[model samples]
Target: MRIAVAGSTGLVGSQVVAVAKAAGHSVVGLAREDGVDLTSPVGLDERLAGVEALVDVTQSPTIDIEAVKFFETVAANLGDAATSAGVSRTVLLSIIGVDRVPQYDYYVAKVAQERTHRVHSPGLHVLRAAQFLDFPGMAIRWGRDGDTTTVDDLLSQPVAVGEIARVLVELATGERDDDVIELAGPRQERIVDLARRLVAHSGEHLTVIARDVPEPMRNGALLPGSGAIIAGPTFDEWLSRQPA
Candidate 1:
């Protein structure tokens, strides 16, 4: 089987490449560094030619409205081109509970991506994955004071990036679909707690402050719903494996 992985240079996408190759599939890497501009879709048709499946794990550069446009455009261009090229299936890696959290900038765009792609490719398989175990580390970017970090507490079931990649490959080679599959970690934990642990583990002296965030973050909006598939490695287990 031949599979094309979008955002192939990313953390999750790179794992998909490795996993697919190990599983004996011919992998096509799509990335800006590889001369594939997903935003513009130049030479994209030629790239999709003879490709059996396309797994999109593309992410935006910014966390604002640009993310929405990025997903929308990529969804339209990729789905249309892939269909024209006779690509059998389209697989997407999305946020698990994005729809319930409209106040978020990125989550809004993800929902749009899902809707836009299905119109062009009816065989799109949407995998709504949970947060990555390393997500807490991202809190540092929210803005860090001299010796304190404001990490909002949110209910999250974080999965390992490798586990997400494994599931992505299984969806790509197996079948076509209009279904949404939810992927989550072994258990749930507080985002602030994870952030504090990461800071201590990394030997940071910053004092972690749990600040009140928007209602969207405080509620269980980002957590997986009922019937969600639980993937491997609890947060503690995953963190333990990472280098200190």
Candidate 2:
């Protein structure tokens, strides 16, 4: 099967490419680093020529209106390009609770992306996964304040990025299901605690301050629903595997 993966260089995208290749599938990795601008759709139509499936894992670092617009645009453009190219299925990596709660610009953008996928391509599979274990590390880096402060009080059920990629590969090759599947880690932990643990494991002594953030920014909408599927290695297990 020929699969096109957007954001193929990202934390999740790289894993998707690896798993798909390991499964003996041909993959077209699309990312800005690779000269494929998903936000523009310039070469997408041609690039998706023989693609049987498309897994979109594109993301932006900014959590603002521009990010939302970028996702919406990319989804719309990619959905249109895939549909026109006669792609059988397009799988989108989304987050849980995007629709139930309207907090945070990123969630709002994700909802828009989902809507675009549905409208532009009925043969779409939306997979919503919880935060990945590496997310805490990302937060630590992003929220670092000269080694003084970091974001805390947030909650997360972070799965391994590899596990999420495996699930995506499975979904891409299986029967087309125009449905949304929710995936999460085995356990939920406070973001602050997780960050602290990661820091301690790294031989760093950084204090994480747990502050009350807005419900939206706290990813209140990202919490998995009752029927959501939980999978993969637990946070503790993943943490233990990290290099000291």
Candidate 3:
């Protein structure tokens, strides 16, 4: 199977490429360095020839108000090209809880992408994955000056990025199911505790203050439902394996 992965140099897409190759598939990397940009498909049709499927894991460069518009623009560019390429299947990575709530602008854009794929590619396999274990470090400054670090008591099931990439290859090549697949970590964790563990792993000191977070991110809202698949070396397990 010849699979082209957009954003092939990114955190998720890179892993998808490695996994796809490990699973005995030829990969076409769709990135600027690869001489192909999905945002402007000038010669994309020529490149996508004989490609079976495409996995879109392109991410917004920023985490601000403008990211919503940026996401929509990127999705439109890639979705239209993928549909035109006559690919058999298309897989897109999405977030959990965004489809129903759409509380954040970025979340709304994700839903829009899924909807567009639904109309364009009938065999769109949507993988609504949970937050990544590496997300905590990116969330806030925790132990910069060895002081009390404040964090939300938001509960979430975060999976390893490598694990998510593994499943993406499975979905992209295994079958052409159009249904949404929910994926999450095996155990649920709170932000404060997760922060504390992360700091400890780095041999740092900081008092963790767990404050109340907003709705739809608390309790079991971010956890996967009964039918959702649970795949992991768990969050704590994954953290322990990280380099100090």
Q: Count the backbone clashes (under 3 Å) in each candidate.
A: 0, 0, 0
Candidate 2 has an lDDT of 0.82
**Tens digit of per-residue lDDT, candidate 1, span 1-244:** 9999999999899999999999999999999878898888677879989999999999888778678888889888898889888998899999977888787788888888888888876378989988888788888657488988888778888899988998899899884243788889988788899999988888978888897766866777778878777887898887788788
- Candidate 2 clash figure, as a count: 0
Clashing pairs in model 3, backbone N/Cα/C closer than 3 A: none
What local lDDT does model 2 show for residue 12?
93
lDDT of each: 0.86, 0.82, 0.77
Model 1 spans with C-alpha error above 4 angstroms: 175-178
TM-score of 1: 0.94
Sort the predicted structures by TM-score, highest score first.
Answer: 1, 2, 3
Better of 2 and 3 by lDDT: 2
Q: Which stretches of candidate 2 lie over 4 Å from their true place?
A: 175-178, 216-221
Write the number of the candidate with greater TM-score, choosing between 1 and 3.
1
Candidate 3 C-alpha lDDT tens digits along 1-244: 9998988998888999999999899999988879776667577767777888888898877654577766666666666677677787888999878765556566767777777677766268889898888877755473344577677676788888888888788888865363688888888888667888887888866677776655777676677888787888786888878897
Who wins the lDDT comparison? 1
